[model samples]
Target: MAMAFQSILPTLPCFLPASNLPDGIDAPAVARGFATLGAWSLDDFTSDAMWRDSVALTGTLRTFYSAATVSAGWTERCFARQVHAFQLNPDAARVVRPAPGLGWINIPFTFATNTPTTTCSGFVSLVRGEGGWKIWLLRTILEQFDGYPNVDEPPQQPPVPIDGAEYECVIVGCGQSGLSVAGRLQALGVSYVVVDKVSQVGESWLQRYESMKLHTPRETSHLPFGRTFTDEYPEFLSRQDLARGYQAWAEKYSINILFSTELVSGSWNGDRRRWTLHLRQNGEVRSIACTHVVMAVGAGGHEPVRPHYLGEDIFQGDILHTAQYNNPHQWRGKRAIIIGCANSAHDVAEDMVEAGLASVTMVQRSRTCVIPVEYMPTRAADTITTADRNQYSAPLALNWQLSRLHIRAQIEANPARFDALERAGFRVDRSGDVFAHVHERYGGHYLDVGNCANIVKGLIQIKSTSPNHPIRFTPSGLLFSEGSNDSHLPADVIVFATGFKQNVRDTVRQLFGEDVYDAVDDYWGIDNEGEIRGAFKPSYHGNIWFLSGTSGHSRYFSRFIALLIKAGVEGVEVPVYRGVPGKAHEVEEVGGRGRGRGHKN
Candidate 1:
């Protein structure tokens, strides 16, 4: 009868350790039986049978004896002893199947070993052995084991589309001001689109001469939302770094940009209450409709102005403008002459000199201001705390006051601090000094002393004409007047650093028809012939606004304009300025609030 039971025992359902079972079984009664005994322990005799049944079952073994020790040979002896006891009895009878009335029946079993009688606590199942019930299977349930439930993860949401339908605003430039306006609009949760004629953001700077870098430090050059690279690189960012930083910022914020899209025309549709944009993109014409349009096309996007000089066409040697000066390698080892003494002219001259050019002559029609990248007090090594550094470096009126104090102290100690050429063997033509010359030209109305200082220090040479004779062009390589008897000086190259002209009114007129100028004039309350805020006044309609070309020239001024635009959009009180013609302009103390004016250039 026992032999009949043994043959059928292997077919009976036995509850082994829960760990031994396949996953996803929800049988609670079988699970409870596995939890009661330590069937998962390595000492359990039935563990070997369970491993034999499920070949996937594996356990980690630790050998305590070192390789050099004599006991290392006996390590396997201990393992063999355990294996022999398990093989002799196998403890296969302890595995059990639960009855309906009894919770769990523990049928004790003994290991069939000749060495000694070793008993282990386990459970046994009963099988119909031909005529009567007989012990069939045995297993020790692992009492302390627990099973974790599985959870299904939720699905992911799809991405939001770029250049989506129904844009609230459309800004037409990717330069500093355009970026600022786009960022502000984004912060307000307003849908907006930015379009640029160039293929990449900040290409305007990339197209400039190799020597060009930001005049302002990164702390002041940062756009809206406090996005800047100054925190990472304390030094001034080169042109390429600046361009890449702008591109990274646009990507980080996911700013919608339509590259290589030229704005052909845009008109205010009063009936639809939206502006219709006619643009040319990749040889295809597309029109977009938006409630507001911001024209931030900036001052330098159009073709450069090449003045019709008398001998310009006749000169056989290379003659390029500052805008076209890409690299100095072509002019290396040659006598390069750069015309005009503005920032570009100075920069080009320095670059040519550094690139192994034989001689770099700067032909100056007038002097230029060359201020240091940062004033001494604003430098990182100036020994100021981090909090005070930002405050002192800010573009606020109070910050300017601190800067002026520092400048005054330096200038008073040595007036020559403002004149570098005079110290470098070049005579200063001080008919009235640089400050007097500036006061005579623009009057006190718009003169910035720092700009005046830069102009004086950058003047390397002053052209002088002899009495009764036309100014001579010297053969010794110097620029002289047309009437001079001296021979024309030969130059390898000539570059013009004449400043940029801010002329967005013509562009606006061409796009929106003649009505835009009149509308803008009336909106700013400008008299028919009068200029507002040093240029054509800005006009704001609802949350939409336009900052004309004059405002785009200076970086400091553009930042102030951005702030005004933000305040206007947020329904905050507009800042007002009040001052007479000659004195420094002061903001009115109305409600103890005033808007900062753009920097005087």
Candidate 2:
């Protein structure tokens, strides 16, 4: 395996600790093999027979060895071209056996060209077969970025932007989605600029509610190319921590960004195979052209959903969307009603109750899939000896299966949690796949921190609402139908935490024209293959891409996204493989490891 990798990557020497070698393997013979391979490059072994004897391709492992669209070992070839040098730390090498014949090997490596070296770890799973131990899965996690900056220190000089420069790619938004793509682009040596309507790097996160903190642990939230939140940061990152982290990341990478810049309009030039964009930055209109445009704006778009009630006009209270909400201190003595029951609504309700509000009520419209905060993800990188990180490399179907089993186990072990919420008049949805509720539906769930207990203890009131009878606003508050009886809930403020309901298509139409909008596919939601639709992968309109979701999604998928864009930029012909259902052989065409391309775009 080391010789195979060294064939293409001269700078990266894959080291296997002599103590950790398989039972039958001879260390001296391995040393001899490496000594003889000094004269040969990857090109010398061109035939299929060279790799056929040693390598067995299967399942998700194909992603590491080859891609359906590109040639065999395309990923490694690209990585070799991008990275300068790699130094392996043999001390960190270890292997674990979950069962007989199954072994997982982890090795830590570093990039040596930066002021502070970048650390990364690679995982490889092997199965002892009739022939010998063959690699089943190979994965890597970039644990830290090269030359990570210290945000606590006095601000350093920002990178100077080139006047009227043309970029190969123009990324919109500077949040996780945008920065993740930018990090990959920087690694690939792609000329790009990130544009945000906000004034600073972390303004998007900073503008969120002051009381907000991520429910998921800090381990699962690192940006792409391996930049992590420091040890001093909270386990669950606060809004301020995330904000400062984003700012520091941009500085660490010297990412070129234009603040207070809005894209006025955009049009694709099919003739020239590029995009022409009109951007307004600080009152000046600038026109630029690019080979690609990335809409990393986010899933919850700029438009906030504010549902209007019958008598909202006459109501003598503030009707605001959660987007306008800040700390709950202002509403300390007032009665408050929050209109949704997902993560944001739960958070707002908890805040109001904690702030000593006279009345804090959550108006739930639909059944929500609620889980204990303890069940949420912690970083897999935290454990090196365990096979925990392999879960990150699982395919969509496999992940769905694992999630279903895990949720089932959780429900069986803690039935009281769900029962308590149900008895309290909260609709706890126990059916359907949790992954679908998150990745497909986008928001039908909430990871309970303290809100579940608040609901159970009646500190936070739950009023169920339905579309059958619309809510009506009164001079004092809202009128709802409670099991065939009408109930009046008095409130001074109604916060619509109904989420960003605006369709992505509308946002696309508003930015680009109808033609471009029509050309693009519907964004978000999982497709037939269980992979996210119209994102990371190629879109209907070849040069346009959509990136959404949390930091983990961005970190994992950014590699493939960058690879696709890089192929286009370098004029490498990579075909698109659409899989056929129920036919394993036909589907394998989509997962083929062949060495040639038919057409691109």
Candidate 3:
């Protein structure tokens, strides 16, 4: 039946009229105007119903009435009026002629309409053999409301440059590690320059929250060259105190630090045995050549990450991550929800609770092992003799031997104490395969000995809600999967204390490009039979060395990194681990492959 109807249709003509559009009006303008008005181009108007629909949709008179008044069937009336107005053009009538082997013939024409308030127009005509006609292509001009204006002044030219600049070493990043490296190099009589992207030393620490304080004690966290918080504050230092210490250290040592300078790229000039650093400073790009380059850009330098979730876009209240958490003052009287149960989450929760927030709820994803800071032994209070200092300075062999002896003595003196504490509900776990149930019951006084007692006590309510059960998700946040059950808890704000990725690889790739990875892979030197170093791979060229790439070991990071820098400068093989003298054998056996241990070259 469809084939029979097709045989009865009229045929098209051979020739059709060409377009009358002006030269300045380009193809885009014609298309845009046709698209804006209620008209279809010749290409699109072949289908009668589709052409009618286009005309109805873009008509100006229809738009005016629809915008000015609301009436039933207004859309149908607008479409009808647009079709009638389209039929008024003589050019539109002639172009509807039919052509051979086609459904319609083509006739091109240009016309202008003032009702739409547009400037240009063009159209294609189609002619049918039996006398039916309609437009196939229709277009109108789009005027430019804003024209080009006169320019003011010409651009300036760059000045010529001089040569013959020399530097012994150029260190990038002015954080704790960078300053330590520079100080050690200076003591060794090596000339060096320290540069940081920020405007001041320790500005990175200043960016942290107001309640932020060092997790480790000041005595263990001090830099080399004898500059320490103990010289001033005998306890843990606050964020402000840490910043001041960094500033004073830089001033006291007269460490040459080029502030607000960033190293964009660097290359090893094999011919000159030096590194050529392309640097960006004060909107100007410059180059510096140095014999040695030490990168001390610390961990946690990148931006914080927040995962996408349902209805996140529709969230009506305040939402912020730990990176933006300056203080708890704004949240003092507001309800807050802390997401994730890592160290940062716990610390932030404590801060908010202490600041007198109306209500604070911790949404923990997983159970975490918490170790009290005081559990770790403190440095002896009395001044050490020269012999004791020397003993501390000896190689890993003697250091580890003595440390093992000390650890053994402590263990012997407290043989039944840990067992007794476990029986009394202390909930402590060791670092090996033995998983012993330490505590049968948990009570408020269980955390009395720890400084974070309030935070630990808050866990009691959450723990009582579900004995040995994991919370999967609440009306507010989700919990980590443990054995089988799924659950959720309700809260206000969610904070993820879930730590950062080891970003040295990313930083290296961004600064040096991917080619460096090829060299790193070839020189990694990890024994296949033994465990790999994970992320750290040291590279050296003669006496010059690069010591930036390392993995995600958080505990003892600053100290280990300082020791590595010290070893690089002294031209010695970097030790597998840093420990007390005369205990290397025991330390090597237990510490080398332990959690957080990195393989050495």
Clashing pairs in 2: none
Residue ranges of candidate 1 with Cα displaced over 4 Å: 1-166, 299-303, 374-405, 417-420, 423-479, 482-487, 521-544, 547-601
lDDT of 3 by residue, 1-601 (tens): 0010111001211122233433342333333333323343233333321111111122210111111121212233333222222322332222111222333322223333332221222233332222223333222211110121111111121111223244667777887767765665554444577778899988978988887776556665555544345567746677788888888877776777889999998876555656788888999988888766666664324456545455554444456788777777776777676654445666677788778887766543333334445443345553322122222222222222233334434444654644543343434332210101011000011111232455444531132122333333344443434447544444455565544443344565667665443333221111221112222223322222233322111111222232333333334332232222223343221211112222233
Q: Is candidate 1 or candidate 3 better by lDDT?
A: 1
Error of 2 at 261 (Å): 0.2
2 versus 3: better TM-score goes to: 2
Writing each residue's lDDT as its tens digit, candidate 2 over 455-571 gives: 899998887765333469999998876667778889999998877853465677788877677666677665443455566666546677778787777766665565556556766
TM-score of 3: 0.52
Per-residue lDDT over 1-601 for candidate 1, one digit per residue giving the tens place of the 0 to 100 score: 0010011112222232222322343334333343322222222223112110000000101111111221221222223213122222223223322222222222432222111111212333333323323222233211110121110111122122445545667788887667766655554444678888889988977888776775445554555444357577645567887788788767766677889999898777655666788889999988888766677765323545543344555555677777788878887877766655444666676677568776665554433333333433443432222222223222122222334445445545655644555454323332212222111121111112132342345423333222211232233333345543443556676665544434455566678776554343221111211122222113423323454332122222333333333333334443221222122343131210222222221
- lDDT scores of the candidates, listed in order: 0.42, 0.61, 0.42
Candidate 2 lDDT (Cα, whole model)?
0.61
Greater lDDT among 2 and 3 belongs to 2
Task: Name the better of 1 and 3 by TM-score.
Answer: 1
Give me the displacement of residue 33 in model 2, in angstroms. Answer: 20
Report lDDT (Cα) of residue 345, candidate 2.
91
- lDDT at position 249, candidate 1: 66
Instruction: Output the worst ten-in-a-row residue range by lDDT, candidate 1.
Output: 52-61
